[model samples]
Target: MYSKGWIMMELTMNWITLRVRNLEASLDFYHRILGLPVERRFESRGKQIVMLGIEGQPKLELIEGSDPPVKPECGVSVGFEVASLDKAMAELAKEGIPVARGPIAPNPSLRFFYILDPDGFEVQLAEHM
Candidate 1:
């Protein structure tokens, strides 16, 4: 028999892994551009992997040389919180990374924009007002 309170299930996002074509380029985008520090890096099954994130937060894992190479899907993106969208855009401009989409504020408390990573993955940066 099933009861509403009988099942105990907890869900959390541990990490997101992406198979990248170029490790250094991806590293430049994620580590240098986005300023995410590399937490740890290691090799698994002959493939190199890098995890990037702030302490005690979900990680974004970048993997290179994985079997059955994968292409990033369109319309799928990873969003990040930014202190200021204007500052982020200026920094990106200095690095010559163009904005893929707008700094749209659909509501009173949100503004955001998108940029393409080295692997053509959509990276969204948002600032809450």
Candidate 2:
């Protein structure tokens, strides 16, 4: 027999998985350009999954698929906070990644910009002002 009340369980984010058209290119963009370290790589159920992130942090998982979802031009976006937006933008420029939109300030305390990943996914980079 088991008594049921409120079972407290430790919960934290594990990963954010995105379906990608090209695993190698996506991996290069994230691992080389964005500088996320490769956490692990493995194949499961005929699909290849690559995980990237800093150790002990939430990861971004790239799953290989023939028909991945098309990223909308203006609806959905993923965001990341950076220490310095200037440095991030400069690094991105050096890599030939164009800013799709703003280095706009949504508010006085925050600045952000947008860029498209290899799979056409929009990524937002922000810094606290």
Off by over 4 Å in 1: 1-8, 66-69
Error of 2 at 63 (Å): 0.4
Per-residue C-alpha lDDT of model 1 across residues 36-115, encoded as one tens digit per residue: 99999998889889999999999999899855435557456889999999999999999999999998999999999999
- Across 1-129, the per-residue lDDT of candidate 2 in tens digits comes to 766545535566888888888899999998899888999999988889999998998999999976655566646666788999999999999999999999899799999999998878888999997
Query: For model 2, what is the alpha-carbon lDDT of residue 121?
Result: 87
| lDDT values for all models | 0.89, 0.87
Worst 10 residues of 1 by lDDT: 3-12
TM-score of each: 0.89, 0.85
Superposed by TM-score, candidate 2 places the C-alpha of residue 95 at a distance from the truth, in angstroms, of 0.7
Show the lowest summed lDDT stretch of 10 residues, model 2.
2-11
Clashing pairs in 1: none
